[model samples]
Target: MAEEEKPFICFKNGWNMKIEPRNRKGWLYLSLWMLALLPIVFTFTWLMNRELSTAQSAAFITGFTLVMIGWGFAMSRWMKVRSEVIDMNLMIDFMREREAQKKRGRR
Candidate 1:
């Protein structure tokens, strides 16, 4: 028998850290992110050309990650079922578990 398809708008892979679009809206959002990518890279490159310190680079990465996390939360909230959004906390927990496993393997 064929496997059933999930109704997730965005399918997030915790292990590889990729968010795949599962629906039209998800695809649209993905396209938007792609469009924004060029300017984001350009700005980062421009700033780096100005010689940002290690601390500033670290701060930028942290802020960008937080923004992505917030985007994930927003995407989760975009679709609700029985007054419930996607459980981002669970997704984050899974990602964290994967990271921990990688760290353990390295030791």
Candidate 2:
């Protein structure tokens, strides 16, 4: 039997999805560090006009991964879902076009 088709918006179904959400759990750890550090580093220096310290400038680096939390999974999931939907739609259109051409040829 053919595989059942997934719902169009179901990223959790993992059909044609490059990475599972389970595989990316480590990102949460990274994001935690980032969330803690970004505010301390950027707030006093860039936003507040505080002078940069060799250490303050460097403190920002540790939080880089945490800041990524807001975007990473959401963006990757969006991209994967979009790519699969586009591909499925393209396949459907191509098959319809082929069928139309075959009917025309028969006339």
Candidate 3:
């Protein structure tokens, strides 16, 4: 039989915490992208300071610009995904609270 999936939970100050997995994933991806970009950026900067043929400089500049644009796009996507995750988590928390209130009222 398949194992039951458990909800992600965090406990602090005797209270349960609800964390959105999507937000966590988004942050993880963003961090990974940043780590991966560090070396590429350093290399680009090093190349820019060196003497190079016109074609090589142009190529480096174009590649660097494209990388920056991609980074921006990734950041924007992470923001959007994080917002959506927060909204969904809020809804889930609301429902859980409502259910808890109903159970208390029945007692």
Candidate 4:
């Protein structure tokens, strides 16, 4: 069964502490995900400078860029999915409120 929820966004709701990511939303996660991958760039440069042969440097950097880019794309998709869930939750609340009002009017 779905759990009952108190009013959202108010400090009174116990969920306020846990649902914080939904409050700030996507920009933060996207930025953090990108920042998280940035260390890979430096690590790649270090490896190219130290371990890889001159001929391998270009290929290594290219592959690393491609992998990080792919990871960023996946993260973008993940953020979108999470945002959609938040939207759906809001939509369901609105619909349920409307239904409750209709029921009250009939009584």
Q: Judging by lDDT against the true structure, name the best candidate.
A: 3
Q: Is candidate 1 or candidate 4 better by lDDT?
A: 4
Instruction: Estimate, for each residue in 41-67, the C-alpha lDDT of model 3 and write its tens digit.
Output: 899999999999999999999999998
> What is the per-residue lDDT of model 4 for residues 1-107, given as tens digits with 9 covering 90 to 100?
99533222211222331222334434466568769887887888777778667679878878898988888678655654454234445667899999999999999
Ranking by TM-score: 4, 3, 1, 2
Q: What is the TM-score (0 to 1) of candidate 3? A: 0.44
lDDT of 1: 0.60
Candidate 1 structure quality by residue, lDDT tens digits, 19-84: 455666556756775675667567656766776789998887787678667765665554322122
RMSD of model 4, in Å? 10.1
Q: Return the top candidate by TM-score.
A: 4
Worst 10 residues of 2 by lDDT: 5-14
The reply for model 1, stretches above 4 Å from the true place, is 1-26, 33-42, 79-107
RMSD values, in order shown: 13.0, 9.6, 9.4, 10.1
Cα displacement (angstroms), candidate 2, residue 74, comes to 3.2
* TM-scores of the candidates in the order shown: 0.38, 0.31, 0.44, 0.45
Report lDDT (Cα) of residue 54, candidate 4: 66
Native-referenced Cα lDDT, model 2: 0.52
Among residues 3 or more apart in sequence or in different chains, the pairs in candidate 1 whose N, CA or C atoms overlap within 3 Å are none
lDDT of each: 0.60, 0.52, 0.66, 0.61
